[model samples]
Target: MPITEVFKEEMGIGGVLGLLWFQRSWPKYSCQFIEMCLMVTADHGPAVSGAHNTIISARAGKDLVSSLSSGLLTFGDWFGGALDAAAKMFSKAFDSGIISMEFVNKMKKEGKLIMGIGHRVKSINNPDMRVEILKDCQTAFPRHLAARLFTGSGEDHHFKEAKSYPECERFHWRRICGHA
Candidate 1:
């Protein structure tokens, strides 16, 4: 592959990956944020299924690419994509003016569990160190839905709307149903 000037070898991995993902050279702060994410998740995640799959593939004598692909293919709603679903829900609730407590209660009433609220292994007492480390830097990188609504540039485009939920206009049905 021809290496363009924008994605030169001299640039950090985060900057190169960010350019590929976001299609632009992110600011220094954004690159740092991505690097922090990479650092936190760079360790061997023994508990997650993806890591397990990768290990199994390597043990079975699969090549590096195959092993990595095996792990990446395991990502879905339960694991790697949980945050994505949460972002959508957060954006929907914010746009609809549905308070966070109300949104949680409504989801409960409908028998739908909230994504990214809990973990398969980690709990309140036994928290993931990576998550704790990231949480410690939350002030530097405010990713709350309300924060995104105000700072249009900082937000990821995927968090702009909820695919599962219709537009806010259809929210009237929810109000009607609550009264029933």
Candidate 2:
């Protein structure tokens, strides 16, 4: 039933109660599932091409929406479009009912980078270990893990980088030894 009809039928206090009940019991609805997905996406903060571009532009002082639009422009394949291509390769591989070395080679030949293989900052062998945090969160809150994991991972990445500097090391040691 449409929301208008439901409200019209319920009316006044009844309508208010009904809306409150719906909102309070929302987790039982399919809409809640979609809300979870949206939360996950939002938590990622547009790490992809267009989103990153927008973030960079915003850092340089573009207004909110226009900066985001600038970032969205980079989402297209011609810029750094590998997500769809990688997904297609995975689908083809899975549908073929085989996981042979030949199949892997075929994906490589087709320019698939084996999702989550490389970090723009981390070296080829030392990929980020943020997956461990997600794994831990999964046992507690599986539905919300992905969204929260993205945020936590970004923070962990920055923290690790910050601590890598000699200045950060000195500051940390001085504070720990009560030299500050």
Candidate 3:
């Protein structure tokens, strides 16, 4: 089937974003919730590794696409790649019938750092406002299993104060579980 037809058949009318809109039978507020997530994670600043690399490449006379590619290349495990790793971990645990708390405790027992758990600067006292906004969005989907699991785990470990790692994990889980 044509891509447009497939989208129309699956989502009624909208495109990719429209498909996301219909996922989980979410209400209209889901769009705003997703937009908020995008905005918050859009950019940390020019000082961030990705932006800094892009800027350096541009100043070094690289073309726009090359510069952008150079910046994107810098996003590896330590930079912006933790989301994938965390999602895999969450999925594996869930699939293996391990509860969220048990998974967290297993990681802790192994002396493993939770990928999306902490921030270098932000802490319980100096919380990230973006995280707060996303947490508020959770109120709209109180019965979401992944949301509840991640939120509870994050709060138990104090990661909720630093970042929206739980929400990120929930998003990945939903996608992997075919709910997205």
Compose the digit string of candidate 1's lDDT tens values, residues 45-135.
5547788899899999999999999998888764577777888888998999989899999999997768778864576778789977776
Superposed model 1: Cα runs more than 4 Å off: 1-10, 45-128, 142-180
lDDT of 3 by residue, 1-180 (tens): 356665555533223454554443333454455566667876565336877899899999999999999988888765777766778888889999999899989998997767666864577888888877777776654334444455654233343455555565567446543676
How high a TM-score does candidate 3 get? Answer: 0.32
Candidate 3 clash pair list: none
RMSD to true structure for each model, in Å: 18.1, 21.3, 17.5
Query: Candidate 2 on 14-43: residue-level lDDT in tens?
Result: 333334544321122223333444444454
- Segments of candidate 3 deviating more than 4 angstroms: 1-49, 60-64, 99-113, 118-121, 125-180
User: Whole-model lDDT for model 2 versus the true structure?
Assistant: 0.51
Candidate 1 or 2, higher TM-score?
1
In angstroms, give how far residue 63 of model 3 lies from its true place.
Answer: 4.9
Every model's TM-score = 0.34, 0.30, 0.32
Clashing pairs in 1: none
